[model samples]
Target: MSSTQLRANDPQIPSSADGSQGLPLLVLGALGVVYGDIGTSPLYAFREALHAAGSPSVSFARLEVLGLLSLIVWALTMVVTIKYVSFVLKADNKGEGGTLSLTALARESFRGRPVWILVLGVIGASLFIGDAIITPAISVLSAVEGLEVVAPTLAEWVVTITVAIILALFLVQRFGTERVASIFGPITALWFLALGVSGLVHIVEQPSVLAAVNPYYGVRFLVVHAEIAIPVLGAVFLAVTGAEALYVDLGHFGRKPIVVAWFAIVFPCLLLNYFGQGAYVLTNPVSEHPFFEMQADWTQLPMVILATAATVIASQAVISGAYSLIRQAMHLNLLPRFHVRHTSETQSGQIYMPQINTLLLICVVVLIISFRSSSALSAAYGIAVTGEMLITAALLFVVMRRIWQWSLLFALLVIIPLAIIDVGFFVANVAKFAHGGWVPVVIALSAAFLMQTWMAGRRLLISKTRADEIPLRTVIESLTKKQPLTVPGTAVFLTSDVEGAPTALLHSLKHYKVLHEKNVILSVVTSSSPFVADNDKIFYESFTPHFSRVIITFGYMETPNVPRALVLAKKLGWKFDIMSTSFFLSRRTLIPAAKGGMPFWQDRIFVALAQNASSATDYFRLPTGRVVELGIQTTI
Candidate 1:
């Protein structure tokens, strides 16, 4: 299909054709994708920060406890509310929000902005991807670790179960998660309710702990012993780690729904839990289950099960996010061409990419075997999150100047505080470099290398092939002496553009110089976000003087249903039943062609990505028997 048509703002969104149910599903599903990581952060944030402060006795009299709460609330206000909600949410490009999206905006607008800024933005986004890998690992382990409390001896068993659960989730991705997603929102909603309930019970028991919210406690705690505070701040920032996920995933749910959901349910529950954890710690001298200690002993099983399910759901959200990010990478020419399978027909946001799933599964397993506990993963988590925050800061600067036309003073006021706070987390996490942070660094480095290589290779391929990409009009005038003969059926060419490629037409002529049985239809398929509109459809009346051309677009949310698209195209005038007509693809297999143009290294990389790209038949969803391949050699 066409890419231009699927933009989220397309009128197709509220169309009578889609029915009224799609919007609500999209709103909830988007919330899951966006909040999964942040939602699960509560599992360790307060606990780790508390544990780091020398496991201070649970009491309102203890200044460390009050300081910890103050740090938690302020960090959330700065990193999550101020930076992400107020600033990053406004830094969007066509409803698409991400580090890369921001980078593009910056590069396009502030072309000469300091090179270091761009570098930081890339590093940030790349690291976020790495964080994505570890999120699944740590979140799952944190939840399943509960088994130890259930049966201390079952710790090993818990690991096995956690691994198995993760494996099953990845394996079933190809089958699609549309049906499962229908309930994810409701289930996640319930999980938040449980967390709130647990927090409420503690709040009622010890009302005085609420005083920790006062800013004075945080200030005194930090200055009293700033040395220890440095490391403690490391854990404090963890509370707000996934805050950016909310901004990046804004496209999934419109701003209104996400804002509504956050204020109505998500935000309150999170605060209560943070306060509740503080209350529980303040009351209990010995908390075997600091979190479960916040709840009654009889309620253990329910919390355990809810926590387990919630964590798994959270991990799954990152897994899906990795898939979506990679898909976007492919579209933007920063990744090798991989098979992208549409997991849902009705819900465009649902997608399953195999390469990404396998990577997540492998990395998560490795993370568990190496770090072994939620505490260890803690060292790895903040680095990626912090790095991503810096990248988002740079991106927001661009959006302010370019899109919003805000003055530099205004932009700096918004971004500087973010840089300061995130820089602290970054430095603290650097101390953890040798601990468990290496995994995320390794993943980020790998992703960055892959992206650079793919981009370098594409630049070479596109540049080399530019001269050879024969104009469509030129192809028709030079080759076709008579008008294209109309026949019993339409013959569609899998064209790169609706018009172009003398080689394609020449091949068509070489195979059958004169049309004998089918009308010629040149079709161009475009890429757009999974959930967008379709409006740029066009049928050319005069191209190459002999052949007719047509363009069709598909939202990334929609699968390349060739037959379905053909039916729609036919209704618009080009008649071809995909089930009967053959689909053709031009594949260039690069051999070390010594020296037409591209750099030597580029030639090799091109060969690599070309070799790695999905087979056209499967990528295009063509019936194997009915598909045809044209092995064409490019000058490069």
Candidate 2:
């Protein structure tokens, strides 16, 4: 089987045919994409923890530096290395990985209906969107804040420069990640190298910082300084903020490349830098930006410029991840269909969504303006990152117990400690509710509501439509017995239920009083896997001499193009002609009812979402001129 057809939930790790040949390149690409978010954390993560450690009684000293460094080191080891790389990465859905992808897998594996699992998936995806906005704002702001260190006089231009950089980053997304991907690997490689070198320089001066690797300082600090541990965790969680991205981008780089990249280069560099910062902090107790201060005076300006570039690249990973996530949401019926434009001809996953891009840009810009500084934005960051991680750990337990067929004891044994750790971080971040933490919580709740409403609204629409729907067999038999005025061309009515008469077909018969010479009831299904084989793409069932039910299957990661897929109909003796085909669609105008299943406000939200959703004609790549949409009002 081709690599794309490999199931993500498959027990074994997939090996690419060219895996050995391109091992180095794949590792490089993985570094650029998978590691971008966590890689850039060194810019502000250590600094933020320092700020968080500031209590009235606490002072910047060797103990504090060692304790914070230990916390960061262990956080990375537990969160990224052990939890994600070793465990969560193993849970894939047909070679695909992400919150929604794994959610679908676990949901399917459950013996009975598991609605709560769906809620978990939506919340994970929503908080990811929250992370999407904040990563760019905080990353760019922190990177640009280096200017304050380079030239104290340029401090006032920081926000403006940050905004300009963010705008440019979002503007170029249309060209796709492929266009800018080549430079990402080398730049990030150099960034990590610089991180190690700079930290190495300071560690030589105060080699005692190396002792933080023992993890004893980390545990001791939390125990001894129990009073401020909560706030400290919120900042310490920053060390592994982008750890989920490792699992989210699993499809792009595969399991081996990502895991290999993390241990071999990414993990070690991050450790060195965090420890180096600890060493620097011990000497310069009152330093504002210790990361920049760790470098030599002459290299400070160049490091600032490099950091800015790295932050932009970091933002790209989050943006592209959001696109992948929303596309999955749409496929699984949790969201309205949006236009997904393929930017690279060679790679199917290299897609861009204009609506998501614009929305994210606006949110990021507003955040930069509102917070005006990275330190302020930092208060909003940990909540989403930790919340998403907690959700992932929850889903991981489900995958183990249900999908992986592990015993309950085995599952609990694995997840309990991870849960305790995740819950600790989540609780710590939650304490920041008054300090901008509500920003992400609010965004997550809003997004989860929209997803739930969309799914519920679609179910209601389908249920209501089925009330009046006739079996296609009955329609075909009736048409054969009493032939209506037959037209020359073919008519294709798209419907969700292939067995039932399409609403558009029923409407067409009542108004036009005619049937086409050839009629096809078409239903397109999204499979759970990432790609479907061509041989199994189309399934055809002929109901009568001139009537047929056609079903086309597309993997969640693949686009559904009707004209291209319909070409396969010729194999079943159905001559296909796009010019002679007339596509029929049913557009429902949903009206909120006082006694509907959902809340009245949610019903209204569903109505608005359905109204603005992309049309079936454009989504299915139907010929615009030959398409007709029949509108129907439904009270639900």
Candidate 3:
């Protein structure tokens, strides 16, 4: 059966929970977390676009500056405002939004699961990881590079300072961000205010640059300079790099707060900053760092300090996002289980994954040392963002047609243009493959390959075990005829297959020659939804007087606690006592056969991943002293 089918009931679209906290505070929180990445783009996006247009000389043509500004303005309008904030945010599944959430929603709309849809989700998620790694490297690097503007001699120290700052950021993740997060909203709001004030000053000085608001200038430039359009478009995409964060963070801030923040604060500040940079370039075309150069001399140092803080907040958001994404992937069976630590008692979303944190730190450091400058790293940035956007567009199309039940013509009208824009940006970024684009490409492909291998190996192992095991009914019938010695305590044997007797239970019967009075054949299932209500969390069935089957379900976004979920069984008349209950689990040792299942290399990868997976006792939050493990050998 499909993952969505495991859900007990169809998911309900609930209202946002922001009412208790008040809209103003939620909006502030949204500004800090949701808008951090895109908010900081003005630091380097415009300058990079100018460089792509071959404007390295002292004076740039008015057409080039105006055209690039126009493109930035309209891209933000079409991509972020219309597509994501207005439309995509509404596609939340059970008040959660992400690639997998949307994928689950789309899967539920059909009677049968579609492999193509799952592939799209996997690709989107994998590319998101690539974006996660590059975002921190480039954001922090770009912000630190501002030092070069304040003192030319300090340019040599940029990379060293950036590495130190990044290392510090990752190291502190174990402590959790609950306390630090409270200040994030205020600091980021101040940063945006600074951006607006700085840009407004320049815009008033050179009011003529405001003409770039006209989309005609952008389109005309692209057509007129078709030869350089590809590279320029690639650079232009940097402005909208963090747009996906809007939808990814929908569950945290809700639709209204994020939308209000964007329209009221973020959108205007970003536009003003981009326009300010254009104005600064128009008069003093030789200025290399338009963002830092446009500022007053007295404010330059403070701007650098503020920019560094904002970029750190941005990096924090991406790192947190990676943790959430990998957790979802693990629960959905797309990846192996990793150790998940809850950093906050109040907030369920505040989780820390050591494995992910260490991986990101290493990747970000390598990218900083290899690329050296934000301008060089810019080449690697757009491809992952564009690819992820394209996949989101594809999934959005399916959702519009199947779930929303929009007419074919209407869905086409809405998605076709957006798809075309995505394709254009993707193709433009692909032209940058040789420069630095291959970094994210390689990262994404490796991630996708690992997920595929795990999934395939799991299916093979299940098939092999199913072929060898006896059905649960047969085992029960045999036990009924000649029952073994009955113990007083309860025994819960966990298994993936509800139809077959658990391997642990079979081994116990074979070796111990006894059965517990109250035996529970427990199975844990992960649904496609983000959070499951307590009412539908457990399903229980009795096959005999002593043998019962219990299924506990958890949402993909949740951390499964089998013992806690089992407590809910009391409501169904099952008297449960933790002290008298013994949890039984089968620990398999996978041996690869020389033949059928997967290629030799993939078998090795899957085996390594399995070996590294967290123990079921800890993952299920079971009492260590009350758990018993049975070791078994399996080959595929």
Candidate 4:
């Protein structure tokens, strides 16, 4: 079996294939892609936390600064380092890790498909999409807002400049990021180095700022300020918003590289920066933008420029992640198929989706223009991140108990506190609903609703079609007794149901009154795992002298290329020729029913989604000229 096909519980599976020689390079790559979100947090996390504790105009006491800093420090340590790096990373499905990957792993522990687990996975994925849309808007806005500090005269142009940069970023996504991606590591490394050095200088000025490292300060602040704790927790969560990338990008760069980068470089630098900001705030108590103000006047403009670049890289990581997540959703049958364009010849993971990119661009631009400031958008950000984190914690418990075979007591002991922390953050963010938190909530809910509708609608359509479909065995028996005029070439009928006669095949017989010399019933099956082994890709069975069944299995993380997979049939004793073959597909035209399966609104939504979905020819990477689509109008 391929390494990717191994179960999560297998002890022999290696965490990564990159050996010792490649470790350093992998670490560099992790810095750019994995840590982009959290690395840029210093720009506004501390400031937002401070604003939440008291008025921005108020000069907080030394204790308040230390307390807030303490909370930020431990939040990173507990949430990112412990929960993700040490624990969640071990629950990877085969060698891949993400919300959906974990969901697949957990579902595999059961005897049959479980509805609750599927719902959790859908919700987790939906919340992540919400995060993807908001990250670019807020990260770039925060970085560009530094212009207000640079000139104060450019404050009016901040939104305009931000929108222009965002527009340019989305426009270039079509060309692929392979070339520009090389510089991401170096640029991000320099950004982190700057963060450490600036903070170290301030720490030297007042060594006392390091006191925030103790948990006592963080605890004391929460106890004393209980009334404001919810808002404060929500704001502090901004510090670890991008922590999910650690587990999400595990397949790209291994666990070791991400952990090493976080502990050795990313973590220390973030600490220095947060401490430096706190120390700077102590001396210059009224500083509103301490991140830019902490730097010397000569370096402030350069800092702003570098910060903008870092934020762009952060946006890129999340945007790319969004593409990967949506692809997984499509393969798992949770969504209608979208046109997926592979941007790199060698790397299957490098993909670009035009429809997704355009939608993201529109939503992001609307957000930037409507909010007009990073602080305002921050109100809408924490809800999605916290909601996703909570879902991960819930799924982790199931994996521990069932997949790993851990004792129930042991699993509960490990997961409960972590879940509680997640709940705290989630509840805190929920408090911001009227204040703008409703944005991500609305986005996530809408995405989840669409996914449910698609899945439900497909189920109904399948059931309805199956009821009308003739049994393939019966059809083959009838053909044996009375054969029609045989055509010379092969005809492959594509279907979702392997046992039922394909609608196209049945229609062909009724209309043309002819049969091909060879007929193959082809069905594509998506595996629960991320990638399937080539050895296990094709399943073939011959029903009669002229009829056979071919099932091609693809992993949820893969793009289904029917023509390429069909080539594997040669190994199963079937001669496959793309040039001489004709592919038949049943094109569905869905009409909403007056009563039954779904509500009127959802039925309408499902029909719209079906209409907009990419054609099977494009989605399956089949040859366009050899394909014949037969339209079948159906109601549900």
**Cα lDDT for residue 385, candidate 2:** 84
Q: Which ten residues in a row have the lowest lDDT in candidate 2?
A: 1-10
Candidate 4 or 1, higher TM-score: 4
lDDT of 2 at 80: 86
Against the hidden true structure, what lDDT does model 1 obtain?
Answer: 0.69
Minimum summed lDDT over a 10-residue window in model 1 is located at 1-10
Q: Cα lDDT of all candidates, in order?
A: 0.69, 0.86, 0.91, 0.91
Answer with 2 or 3, whichever has the higher lDDT: 3
lDDT of 3 by residue, 1-636 (tens): 111112234333324455689899999999899999999999989998999988577588898899999999999999999899878998999889988898888888878888888998999999999999999999999999999999989999999999999999999999999999999999999999999999999999999999999999999999999999999999999999999999999999889999999999999999999999999999898878999999999999999999999999999999999999999999999999999999999787899999888999999999999999999999999899999999899889888888888999999999998888999999999999999999999999999999999999999999998998899989989999999999999999999998998999999999999999999999999998888887678887877778888899898877798887887788777788999999999999988888858997789889999999999998999999999999999987
* TM-score winner: 3
TM-score of each: 0.86, 0.94, 0.97, 0.96
C-alpha positional error of residue 580 in candidate 1 after TM-score superposition, expressed in Å: 6.7
TM-score of 4: 0.96
Tens digits of per-residue lDDT for model 4, 471-560: 988898899889999999899999999889999999999999999999999999999998887767778887776888888888887779
Per-residue error (Å), model 4, residue 387: 0.8
For candidate 2, give the lDDT of residue 151.
92
Looking at model 4, residue 38 earns an lDDT score of 94
